[model samples]
Target: MMRMFLAAAPAVLLALSSAQAEPVAYEFDLSHTEVSASWVHQGYSRQSLQFTDFDGTLDLDLETPANSTVDITFNLISGIWAGAHHEAFVGHLNSGDFFDTAVSPTAHFVGTSFETEDGETGVMTGDLTMNGQTHPVSLEVTLNNSGETRDGRSKLGFTATGTLLRSQWDMGYAVPYVSDEIDLFISTEMAVPAPAE
Candidate 1:
């Protein structure tokens, strides 16, 4: 009995430590956030697009980083292409050729797993739902900076990048000519609201 207890001690301690770790909740700062993408156009130039509206929540567990979570939603029709043919580009993106925003106006991402090295560089895996389709995706993230605001609100800043094949979502569009792979990039600041007085 004594030997068995000794052997189980470490596991019990680990469980206790994990149970004591709590995740910090954060609200995204929409005004300073950008969820954007880019891709090679006709194998000649790169074109960029940005989602005009998006919101999300993040739970960061400093003690056990893998316990972190992120949930986000994007307005599909809000995508804006940055070029001279902006209006035409946006219209095409919202049509059946791409997102088909009429039937699927919203896209979402819910993180399933998270891991970090040195608590600053990390990879988050999640299911990305777009145009009524869902696929597993991974984002490489870096904690650029973090601190408390002047008013004592906790803040975190980070940037993440990922890539997805548009064809996987039935959005083949122009395929090889327009490029099937889309690169995603997100940079934002999040703040934790102060507790009620």
Candidate 2:
């Protein structure tokens, strides 16, 4: 009986180790990432805005998807308009009427939970902090691809979309005129960094 108990110990420890697998860490590939938003312009057309500077990190647990986590930070001053009147429009957006970037030059998001059915697509819920306000937001996310690159680097790509009310963050300057609802679109690629010598 003593011998049998000792023999089972090794198997039990192995099982525990496998169950506690650590997640893979990845950093945003900034060159391949894009974060942007769009809103209706007085019921006529949808005006677009893009944020150029940001940083993000991801901890992916493929074995247990629920353990995955993500975080992102955007520089509000990097906001840019898409069409004509780019300079003036972006300047106004940075003013108190819209983003009020002068007071809050940065926005941040931290994923609190990740829910998925097929592993390829799912919903991510998190808190978004912008313009001195924090609010819960949900994003529909889709995994574009994941694999090793030609240089032997592990990488993954994803796309996400969501919507938020401008008033929630107290940035409802235009409201019905520029549309209170803002649509968010994001596409990004993340990669594991190489070890330094």
Candidate 3:
């Protein structure tokens, strides 16, 4: 009897463990998403108030928290400056002078690595594609929280900021007014989801 009980112990443990497990998934609801870029001009800084669209996806594992990633997309054509009424500004920004949004209407960020610092804040290394140029961009990230809700939705929220030089990406424009330093501000609330079918 002792030998038989020992033999069945492993199987019993596995069954109990499997029975107690519940699947957890979180998603990013892009409707609550925000993506913006800003640059200094002379002595003042201004931000672009418009974007065509933004899309993102986050797959998180709470147990294995380190195995997570962020994928973000931006619509260059949707950038609105001057309340979107400045045709010259829009024309200049899209005409290879700055963004060249006509040729490349979208930009993307894919995080390849992450490191935490001072608790929840840290840096994320990723590829940021803009103006048809790909560069390794490091951005400061802040992860607020993540959890499963009563509505059967698991979600995550975060804020990320980064700075870039316009001249590096051939995005240089602005004569003596606008500064070369560009800052990106992104606040996101995302749902956990697999790829779209």
TM-score for each of the candidates: 0.82, 0.83, 0.71
Report the Cα lDDT for candidate 2.
0.66
lDDT (tens digit, per residue) of candidate 2 on 134-191: 9887777777777666778777777778888989988888777989888888777666
lDDT of each: 0.67, 0.66, 0.55
Give lDDT: candidate 1, residue 162.
Answer: 76
Please give the range of 10 consecutive residues that has the lowest summed lDDT in model 1. 1-10
Clashes of 2: 0
Lowest lDDT 10-residue stretch of candidate 3: 1-10
What's the candidate order when arranged by decreasing TM-score? 2, 1, 3
RMSD of each: 10.4, 11.8, 13.2
Please report how far candidate 3 places residue 27 from its true position, in Å. Answer: 4.0
In angstroms, give how far residue 184 of model 1 lies from its true place. Answer: 1.2
TM-score of 3: 0.71
In the range 45-146, model 1's lDDT, one tens digit per residue, is 998877766666666665665565667777667645466758887888889988889999888777776655455666667778888889887777776677
